[model samples]
Target: MNPLRLSPSRVNDYLNCPQLYKYRAIDLLPEEISLDAERGTLVHTILERLFDAPAPTRTPELAFALLPTSWEEQLIARPGLREKVQNDKEWIDRVRALLTTYFTLESPATFEPTEREVHVEVNLTESIYLHGYIDRLDIAPSGEVRIVDYKTGKSPKPGWEEKALFQLWIYAFIYWRTMGVLPKLLQLIYLGNGELLRNAPTEADLLRTEKKLISIAEEIVYSIENVSWRPRPSRLCDWCSFKNICPAFAK
Candidate 1:
């Protein structure tokens, strides 16, 4: 059996539709470029760049100034976006709205992050590796650690938050496994509406998350050995690039 590399996003993809997972993680099928994806990347890039300035110099004006260059840098990396968005000015303006909303949530000038875009990986088992990139990491003088993630989309409503929490749980598990200390806070900052969801994870919660990952890894390994990846059709199918090629969508 080949070693399985499972990230939070890939785990979500597999749960959403195993066939989609096979197309992506296994076969490496190409996906149609999405404007929303490009815009999200642009916004995230600008936010990350905002921290590159001196802590005192991190301002909304500076974040806005970083946009054009960030967009240009993104364009160079993903030139396909140039043909996707009809009006670059309008697109940039939309991204500006998100950046403006971000300032309303937290003053970036106030907090000095210990790390940005931090990549982490941990071995779940001999055959499984859990890996992900954290948006920002903050450490207090008191030895408390915080994991911060930025989302360009709207915050999840009541019962739907579990889905959003899943990624943070995985991050918490990784941090605990690697550092031997659970994070004091797990945060998700939604730029769409200036909403911040923060959770102080307990030892019990991390243990539960570890149990969940072990179960997920077992399921993935079984699926791999059996070569059974079924499709799950839902609203998400509407936006899936492979819908035309998927059996669930076939006549």
Candidate 2:
């Protein structure tokens, strides 16, 4: 059997609902194109390319200028995506606002990112591998590493912050296992509302995250072997694309 390939998003799918995972990861069903998700992709692309220029030139105006070309590139990659936006002008304006908010939080001209859209992969075991693309990775002058992720949406509410940080903790775990160095910081930059969430993960925290991931992977394997993919109904189901065919909602 091939090793179970897992990303933070894929793992979250399983954790959220195993049956939803089967539809996406196993059955490979097509999901409805989300305008918000596409917008996030466009913003991410512009930000990634923005760093290519000299630090002094990494200004919000430059980021705004890159929008048209970046969006055209996205249009080429996903032809059908354009139709989903009812108002092109309004949609582009929203993207511009996100870039403007980003500048207020951090001056990209001040520090250079060690990596952007960096692909990270590490094997947890012979049968399980963890991998994903990190939005940004920065190495401080003192050698402390920081993992940063950009969010086009609003920050999660107070009690749900830990749940939101779970994704980054998984990334931290992979970095530690592969690089033999624990990242000193994990940061989430919420462009929608201009809020920042930061965490300093400890060694023990990442170790627990690793164990949890292993257990989830094992559960996935067992479900595959047993041919048991059960739907988990929650408020999130309202947004799930596969709800119409979900067993839990079947009449």
Candidate 3:
């Protein structure tokens, strides 16, 4: 009867650095929510309102203006990012344009929605874990569902598909189990570039995902018993926020 539901993000932490995961999750370090995370929240809020609001009420241009300048401005605080965000003004504009495009690309005939925030608490055999709302969910006339996740970040690569894309699979399974209908699309809409990545999971696809999830969970649980771990050093060390305290990066 454990009320714990796991998400891909928690797994990502263990994958990134187990020691860091221990400090944050077990020791309960004071959480430092990043500016990027905050911006993501804001973007999610705006999109949810736009998509879930009545069809007549949706306005992409309005959401663009609605984004708080303070939150957008605060992205300056990240190291080596003040100039990067500032330089990305054009990029932001392009992203805004893409949002508008989504509205046009999906409105007037797209499934009527009010952008309602949908959160699901799955018992999972009385293990009460929660999954947050998808950025947008469109239920088409054919009873097929589409789960959209908004990503403003730049594309990680041409090889992201094979390299353990746990999140999308999690969402796909969640949608399938929660809603009886099959998903027509599980999409990552890169708001910045209007790029879309999608997958429709088969039984085999999901079985592989389940295996991967279980493997990562086992690693995380094993790391919890001890504390002798350190940062992953290499080029990524230069960018890790934990470098200030990481043994591997000790100068």
Q: Using lDDT as the measure, which candidate wins?
A: 2
The reply for model 3, stretches above 4 Å from the true place, is 1-5, 31-33, 68-109, 114-116, 121-130, 228-230, 234-239
Clash pairs, candidate 3, are: 3-128, 51-115, 52-114, 52-115, 53-114, 53-115
Distance from true position, residue 60, model 1, in Å?
A: 0.7
Kindly provide the TM-score of model 2 when superposed on the true structure, using C-alpha atoms. 0.97
Ranking by TM-score: 1, 2, 3
Query: What TM-score does candidate 3 reach?
Result: 0.75
**What is candidate 1's TM-score against the reference?**
0.97
lDDT of 2 by residue, 77-133 (tens): 997897888998999899999999999999999999999998999989999989999
lDDT of 1 at 199: 91
RMSD, one per candidate, in order:
1.0, 1.0, 4.6
lDDT of each: 0.90, 0.94, 0.59
C-alpha displacement of 206 in model 1, angstroms? 1.2
Ranking of predictions according to lDDT: 2, 1, 3
Residue range 13-34, candidate 3, lDDT tens digits: 6677776666555676654445
lDDT of 3: 0.59
TM-scores of the candidates in the order shown: 0.97, 0.97, 0.75
